[model samples]
Target: MSARRIDRRGFLKTAATLAAPIIIPASALGLGRKIPSERITIGVIGLGGRGTQVLKDLLKLPDAQVIALCDVHPEHHREFENGKGPRLGSTPARELVDKAEQARSGQPGKPCFVTGDHRELIDRPDLDAVLVATPDHWHAAITLDALRSGKDVYCEKPVTHLFAEGQAVYREVAARKAVFQTGSQQRSDALFQQAAEIVRNGHLGKIRSIEVGLPPGYDKPMGSTEVKTPPAGLDYDRWCGPSPKLPYMNARHHRWWRGQRAYGGGVLMDWIGHHNDIAHWAIGEELGGPTRVESVGWTTPDVDIYDTPVDYEIACEYAGGITSRISTKVTEGTKWIGENGWLWVTRGKIKCSNAALLDKSFDRGEWVAGPTGSHVANFLNCVRSRAACIAPAEQAHRSITPGHLGYVSFSLKRPLRWDAKSESVIDDSDADQLLKKSESRAPWA
Candidate 1:
């Protein structure tokens, strides 16, 4: 399709339709009642840092309600209650309780129930959907359960810890016929959309390569620490859901677990998911994985706490001779290298090689300004209409595969070819084994 003929206006019109008001009958909307209005009642499965952020965002939508909240730590429940609890009533244990009380009394508040066991949360008949924001290893399993229960899902980025699980997520979403949106919110950002449109329309002619910068991996040395008994209210086994059990350490417990290989994929999967998503969107490949990957750097040599590469470079090849180079150590920004000129974008600035590329201004007179407003608006609209979300599961799966494949290559320290068709490594035993999930510990297993 010609760039100008791509119909930005029509695309925006479709987005507007997807952002239409959600309508539900007052009776159907009653809390503690049947799952109301295909307008999804959402359960947040991991109420830590990222999950809490998602809960806050979902609260803004009029049609959606938080039916349940689940986390391993009791401290998180305390924080959510102390901070947002009293506003609802006296002491509602979960967000759902508050929501139900508000509905009964005809008051304005969020309705959500709380639980430490995510399995109970997923099994709730009141829930129409779930948001999975747990560690990398737990993402696939939780998502699968949510799907099996006939609920739509919004999972955090880097969707799967292993390449093999992507196909499972794909199959489950298709089989259940559910709406799955990946939390790669960049897809909902106007600036990112604009950037991708510019490249797609040949604003950057004959694109050569794209480079993305992620936060640097831990470059500091690991401090020595002794393993301690699991804390009183924290369900350590549940927290380690699909990952192997190890002695308790402060760094691997909460948010810092992103630095570990067992629970995270390091900076590559951690940060690259955003830009790689944009890169794939700009290139217009519907469903393609990287053909080859190689990496040759390390962020830290610490073998004690974390095992992911700290600093590394990876090259991914696609059809039509296009290549994307992602690095962990670059200054945080995204650069597009093309035959005609280049464009660089970060949160603070956007620059083009010719400087003329910046001269063109998008006619946003009719468009929304920020990402949070635009993206959330889109999802709510789709919930009512049963349309596709802007960042659907299939697209997210394709975008994230590059970073996961890159990690696999770096860990194996060899060139690996991937069959995007089969979502597997070609022929190499070690790489093939890394493609699937590693078994978690017992009990939680």
Candidate 2:
């Protein structure tokens, strides 16, 4: 073993692979685990909150085997220092994997690998696919690199932090002809599909406005403001990736990073992919998203760490005269108002002016899409089938477009007219530049 030196130009610099624990207890031999060649091999990157959740799901797949895991932080006693959850980071994730394997066979799991660097996992020849559950900023870079390596990918949502990155991702996935699934899991829910069925079936008559209720982003100040030393076993610079080089603080890292503009767009950017994804689906737009975005009622904080809006009330106008309102003021999901009656739906419940809308025997609407089963299972099956998953890169890109639009509009304190046909702002170069800040800094570059 040699001392590892990583410069700005490279990660793990020239290391062949990470120092990993190779563990194979006797119980892992059979149990219920699929035999080699019968299972799809998986390498999971970004062992944070979302990554942990997705990893658990991937491990449960009867046809999938998670062989490798990666994260900047080596391990954590708990996923969040501030909150309670499963232990996180690569080592903790590996421990979870080992236990799961043992539980499967009443013995130790198969040999699993761990890495502090993603490059090691991406370059592994044995991996058939990679699950990218990293931060919003790291999604496109990791996805593009994995796609280039000729591996299928299941990347978490909002897919990319910036609009330009989404375009690059779309092109790379197309060029590789890789099977990719964006982690907007709502599409697989029968309830959400039913909601889509209602709107597309013409049961709503003519839709007038759709109101989407989102959470008010970190209302009180979040994360500690104090500057601190980068903790041992944590590579702060690597965690920042292509984002700006900021001083280290617990508040601006971990779960708290979502509050800052440098990393993510607060709750507005996060939930936009979930509920709005459903919103777009119900309408059945071939090329969906708002044609215009304006927000006069929003609250952007003056704090240095958390710069994104804490709350917003935005209006988005789409083609076919469809209009939408997104705000904390609305109910906590999507509500559609139309000429006949109003229908509202969340993951658990659906409310309508008339109860008959949810009748299974009623017209099921011609608007149909797949992932007939679980979201994760669909991605794995699609990997073998070479078919598109329910939530592809392009659809994920479109779903989050208006959130970006609303973000820019709120920041500029003005309304923006969008050319939906061209996917560009109308005659607004300054605003256009904000949407195009997708460049990765050195090393990541």
Candidate 3:
């Protein structure tokens, strides 16, 4: 298939028109008691650890059912069926099957269909939404396909593998009027929510700079260079999907793929979706992005095995005089610095330079200005209510832009100014070119 190029202006124009109305279908307007048959049916596209957790959680919801599972690795399905494989912490796939079946109250119900091809699962007419737990590179492509198939999406974070893909995915989501929730679970955390509200309401006085820190990249040795035969029951070709098809490298599959730039963008890209997003959210620019990004990185010296940065720092300046200093070296949290005092917030804890800062409180409506409920539950609610998900496509796209720019700047060895309106690097043609999609492997491009 030839590459499908969507003209930005025309696509977005149609999207605006389509998204103007928040239509709640009559069938979904059931308020009181509803039968299990009326529940929202879901299909999962990637059955990795994260996907398994999402499937299990959906099973726990009384009004949601996961009817299909898809992944290139068939072992995932086998393990779920045979009740064997890597432990999925809390939400195991085997439990998902049992819970889904029990939701039907022991009556004859549809089997939990499993397949390697995601298209087969997404194409199901009964599929109301798809939970995308694929790698960063596959996120946008799978989301576009799901939206085109008229299904809502709960896509994992670092929304797009490539910077250029964000706009296309955003356009398609709006055009299809599909409810999308980017899997940035931090948005649902109450401490982060409280932190964002405090910053936005000027509890920190005049905002100066924001410090965002992320975890280090994969420390494991890169896999052997010797090309090995693809493992049995794994479709390496399909596993690579739109990414380049190369001989099997054990380290390049599954989670370790994040260390490779071709498929993932290291720790910078992985954690930026969470920390940088809070940076943007605190400054009230969730739908927009940074204006300039300057980055410096440390890579594996004299080693080709792992290419992702071991340590990195980026200074991203947003449009409204806000500077987000991001680094792997700093403490893992977001700290807002200002004229009066500073507020620092991490998972489960919030600290401030002034004790008085914590005393200020907002009304119930003034609490967090984003979607409520846990992230997964929020998506299911939006699927039924047609209300916008907190981390919508625009926010997801905007949140990851700084990380993408950091990569571009680090590669070019210079700062790059970005046109948030154009969603491209300004002035330099070469840098602008890097902002667009590269050719994918055959049959997927």
Candidate 4:
């Protein structure tokens, strides 16, 4: 509650236990048909590109108020209004605080708490939920911490950087009964929902195969070999969080970290959580995944900047003889082929083998793939109503597993047989070793 910036000293104390009960402070609960004063108080962690975009979307909602923000990069919190810093063509975190103030009917807004440590934000009993748009590696740790601290979470996807961390996140969400919305916003798109309905309604009978396309990797390798002084105001050490504290490079510091194996899984992990999730939804396998995975990929020629695969093909065989082929070769949407017909859907377009399938109407209460509102709006509604979100944490975990398996199989250069229930690989000790959850680096571990 103090106005002082949170000091990072001793912040990496043992992670709060995951077994805590759902401790919703009284103000957040029992407000049936509540008024605007009962608006949801949100805290945002990570204020990079995606974080800023999501924050803007949240700002549009009158019932949600962003009360605090935390980012390791202090430049993000720079006051753009004063025009006093190195200007990047990016939105500063302070804009959200200003907007939050305007939303408060011209009265002075509560001070927007800023911190480099997310733990301080999550531990606040006053905060209702936190939007976690941190890097992929930090996703599991931060989301788990928030849920264990009794806050609902809207975690950006691929919900887990490593495959094994999915189950732990899923388990904690279930145990705490906290609403978690994965930031796979495609689940809320109408075209995607229509395609999922066609598939679910048996309009695409006995799915033969689904082809998923994701964004291609960097034509040139990403990241920098140069080690320089950490930028002023940026706590590069805390930014590295659970991953190896590699030397600071501008390329890997902010947005470009997506192309690195340490912080992300290249384009495959970056886009798979969106497109591959649709593939799983259409195949009626949102809760489980393929039994086997095999992949081959090319690591960039120059390892100085990027080491993640530059190109790859992955094939997964699911139960009931369903097959999914995910690669950089196909188009950006999912194409579901089946005995009766096929439906292909993407952000703004939907095409089907039977033209009528595109116009088919569903009966009331029929199963639909998405929520009726924007992804962020749905998370806020669920935060209030205690309803399950469309992109629940468990489904996001299952949806993203193929991407993880693909990366691991490509790195190991071997096929892997997965036991989805056990969340392990079958009979391959080498691949099995890769399935273990990542141990947080020292002090945080």
TM-score for each of the candidates: 0.84, 0.88, 0.86, 0.86
* TM-score, prediction 4: 0.86
Q: Judging by lDDT against the true structure, name the best candidate.
A: 2
Count backbone overlaps in model 1: 9
Q: Candidate 1 lDDT, tens digit per residue, 64-115?
A: 6677777777553322333553222112225544655486559965545677
In model 4, which runs have C-alpha deviations exceeding 4 angstroms? 1-37, 76-91, 222-225, 297-299, 360-365
Per-residue error for 22 in candidate 1, Å, reads 4.7
> Residue-wise lDDT of candidate 3 within 34-115, one digit each (tens)?
2224567788877787777777677766667777888777554222333445744213454567566865687646557877
lDDT at 348, model 2: 87
Model 3's alpha-carbon lDDT is: 0.75
Candidate 3 structure, TM-score to reference? 0.86
Against the reference, the lDDT scores of all candidates come to 0.69, 0.79, 0.75, 0.77
lDDT measured at residue 218 in model 3 versus the true structure, 0 to 100: 65
Model 3: residues with Cα > 4 Å off, grouped in runs: 1-24, 27-37, 76-95, 103-108, 219-226, 359-367
> Which residue pairs in candidate 2 collide?
27-107
Worst 10 residues of 1 by lDDT: 363-372
Candidate 2 stretches with Cα past 4 Å from truth are: 1-36, 77-85, 105-109
Best by TM-score: 2
Among residues 3 or more apart in sequence or in different chains, the pairs in candidate 1 whose N, CA or C atoms overlap within 3 Å are: 94-112, 95-111, 95-112, 96-111, 96-112, 96-113, 99-111, 299-310, 299-311
lDDT of 2 at 59: 80
